[model samples]
Target: MSRFTTACIVGGLAAASAFASTPAQAGYYILRWDNTGICQVWSEAFTFKPIRWPSGYKIVSRPVPTFNEAVNLQVRLRRQGRCTL
Candidate 1:
């Protein structure tokens, strides 16, 4: 690729990264399927509650990258004996 094209791509990526880093208002907890257990969820909306979880669950911010990360967070929270709904 030409130098100009490369520069534009890099610049665009930088701008996107900066925007992604900017903080936004917190949203309500939304539940997705926890494959670590036995649930196969089709929807990705948690009922708007005060965000409660069992001893092994954690209520993390929504929009996690992957299902595995969500499950890991849940497991960690459960390990800590904290409610993470």
Candidate 2:
């Protein structure tokens, strides 16, 4: 094949690979409140900004790759005393 045609094919493959390999966006989060055993919240938002909570209520924010993982982590955190249910 001509050099120009070969170059175009290579460049096109590179571009396609780059686009296909784009990283996933942040989407899963687990929110747990301190002092309340088994109190937890799940979110799909990229950011967590809690505005208010009862006194002594601590917010534990965990970013996870999947919803199931986030829920499992919340359970673990509750067991570990990092956050309540």
The number of the candidate with the highest TM-score is 2
Give stretches of model 2 more than 4 Å off.
1-25, 34-39, 46-49, 53-61
Give the worst 10-residue stretch by lDDT in candidate 1.
34-43
Tens digit of lDDT per residue, candidate 1, span 1-85?
9999999999999999999998653333324323233222111444344333442323344545556666665566556644333
The global Cα lDDT (0 to 1) of model 2 is 0.66
**Model 1 lDDT on a 0 to 1 scale:** 0.49
Q: What is the C-alpha lDDT of each candidate?
A: 0.49, 0.66
How big is the positional error of residue 53 in model 1, measured in Å on the Cα after superposition?
15
What's the distance in Å from true for residue 20, model 2?
9.3
- lDDT string, candidate 2, 1-85, tens digits: 9999999999999999999999775556665454454446555563656644562444466567777777777777777877644
